[model samples]
Structures are given as C-alpha cells and as structure tokens.
Target: MNIDRDARLEKPVITANMTPLQWANTEKYWTLYKKESRISSESDRTTHSLTCCDQELRDQLFSIHDDIFEMNDVNMLKRIKNMAVKSESVIVAQVNLVRSRQNPEEPIRSYYARLKGQAVICVYTVTKK
Candidate 1:
C-alpha cells in the first residue's frame, strides 16, 4: 500500500467504536502505526497480539491497550492490565475497524472498559496473527 501520492487512497475497512477523544487519540497514534508499517512493512506485533488472543482475553486486552499510555506512567503490559482491572469496568464489545496503514482482515478490536461511571477505550494488538 504505497500511500505517498494517492491523496484519495481508500482507507482500509475497520470495525471500531471510539468516542471523539478516543478517535482523536487514535489519530495521533496512527502516525506511529504508519511509520512502523512503512519501515517494517509487515511487522505489526501489536496487531498480531490482538488477533491471536482468545475472544475473552482480546476483549480484556483491548480495553487496556487503547489508553494505557495515557492512564499510566509507564507502558508495562502487566501493569496496564492491572490498571484496567482496578477500574472495575466491565469489558465491552470489540470494534470493527482497520488500521489505516496495513488493513488486516480481522479489524483490530477496540474495547470499551466502562466502570461504575465512566468508559475509557483502547485498541488491543494481535502480537501476531
């Protein structure tokens, strides 16, 4: 997917449900995703992680993955999960949306972790498919 000169290039299909802020957050992160996709071409470790986890774990991971960096000081996977669990939010549905760069068939899952009063989202990676 050479996206250098094609301004009208069709964005890949994805199944994701995100709020305005979450969508904006993803917009910022997409720059990193695009760079990684271009440099590695096919090295989507995070995407693979999301794809491989069982639906249950994938749902759990998605909620934490999306806003981990913002929620926590460090990006430790374990700590991120712990942070999510501590929030007491029920893991919600998986979103159906494609990464802007490498559009995979399994749209990355976007989980909405809604606690007693609020919901925060995150996109879980499929470390490998």
Candidate 2:
C-alpha cells in the first residue's frame, strides 16, 4: 500500500497541536501501510516510516532527538508516539469518544466500526490486582 496512492493509507502530517484521535488515526494508517506493503526489513521499514511524516515533523524529530537517524522503526514510532500523546489529550479523547454517536442514516456496522476507531484514542492501562 503506497501511502500516496491509497486514500486509507495517506500520510498524516503530525503537528504539535494535533488531537489525540488524529494521532491515533495517523498511527493506524501507518500500521496498515506497513502491513499491506509487507515491509520486512528493519532498515526499509525505518526509512519508510521516517519518510511518511511531513518535513516539519521530521525537522522537529531531528531537533528533539540526537540519535533519530540511528533509531530503528519501532524506536522511531515510540518517539513519535510519545510526542503525540499527552495526559490532557487522553481526557480529550475520552470526551470525544463519549460524544460520538451514530448518524440516523448510518448503518449499525459502520457506526460500530466508527466507535471502535474512536476508542483507539482513549488508551486505557490495565493493571492486574
């Protein structure tokens, strides 16, 4: 799945102010792109992952991290994910999820899928008692 060619896999430019849901969507698309493209090599995956972001984000990554160039795809993703998620943003995501509702004309399956997608933004940490 070429990011440019596929609408579902289009590259999302990660900005500092982007909402948690937006970041989740971006990550979801990136994962889909990786799966569909079958990029197996760590080097190739890292290259593609780095290129998927906009130049601004790339510049920010470079500026913030000294070893970005030396990082693999998983580490790069972790870095980006850390930048994207925040405590306040998690509350916002929860609010958005709570506000989400199906349109009157929307099918149940589509509505359910949409809710599921929105739920991704509301990350919950599970702890065993």
Candidate 3:
C-alpha cells in the first residue's frame, strides 16, 4: 500500500463544483454497499453524499456540517424558509418570548426600545418568500 517511494509525483488538480450535482448515488451506499456485507458509519455516509452536492449546497452545508449529527432536515427546512438559519434561531425564539409577555413595568422609552429591537430581529429573520 506504500507506493509513495516508487510513484511519480504529479501536479495536483483542483476541481470545482461549477455544475449542479444531485444526490443520485444513494442506492449505491444504502442498498448495494451496506445491505448485508458491511455497516456504514454515519460520518462515512454523510461525507459520501456531500461529495455529490454542488458548491452552493456545500457552502450552505459547511456551516452546520459539524452539527449534522443533531440536525433534523424537516426542522432545518422550516427554519430556512423563515430565514432563521443557524444562530438566528436564538433571535426568533427570543422574539416569541417577548411577544408573549404581558405589559411589564418599565419606562416608556426602554419599553419602546425593547419592542423595536425585537421588531428588527423579527423582520430580518422572516423570509419574504
């Protein structure tokens, strides 16, 4: 397996995902490879499938790739539609908490400021589409 000493050195080639790549090889991993012969690890399955993704998809995925183990695609999709991707979920949840609160005893200016900050956070988190 150690061919480095005898192998010829060549220039490395960098390939970019210029074209759209769909997840078309699921059958190979799910049915063929792991059907009975071997059990594939979570990391192996994730990396293998990601290799077929386009650049845009890969970049979007990279942010939460490490947290892939805890990711729920259904919930993630809903968050994305709301423009609350990743850390923005905190702001959204906070806004809901504030909105549910009854009138609190506070100065008029401070109360308005709090509401305004929450408004801004909500506006940005909501996706137009």
lDDT of 1 by residue, 7-61 (tens): 5423222223334344434444544545644424333533432332345555655
**What RMSD does each model have against the real structure?**
15.9, 4.8, 19.4
lDDT of candidate model 1 versus the reference: 0.37
Segments of candidate 3 deviating more than 4 angstroms? 1-39, 64-66, 69-129
Residue 20, candidate 1: how far off, in angstroms?
38
Of the pair 2 and 3, which is ahead by lDDT? Answer: 2
Considering every candidate listed, which one attains the maximal lDDT?
A: 2
C-alpha lDDT (0 to 100) for residue 38 of candidate 1: 49
The digit string of per-residue lDDT tens for model 2 on 51-81 reads 8666777788888999987889989888876
Better of 1 and 3 by lDDT: 3
Global CA lDDT computed for model 3:
0.42
Best by TM-score: 2
Clashes of 3: 0
Clashing residue pairs for model 2: none
TM-score of 2: 0.65
Show where candidate 2 strays beyond 4 Å.
1-16, 84-91, 103-110, 124-129
* Residue-level lDDT tens digits of model 3 in 1-129: 334444443321112322111111222233443334333665554443444344555566667556644545344333222222223454564667466543667877866765655555454455686
Residue 106 Cα positional deviation in candidate 3, in Å, after optimal superposition: 72
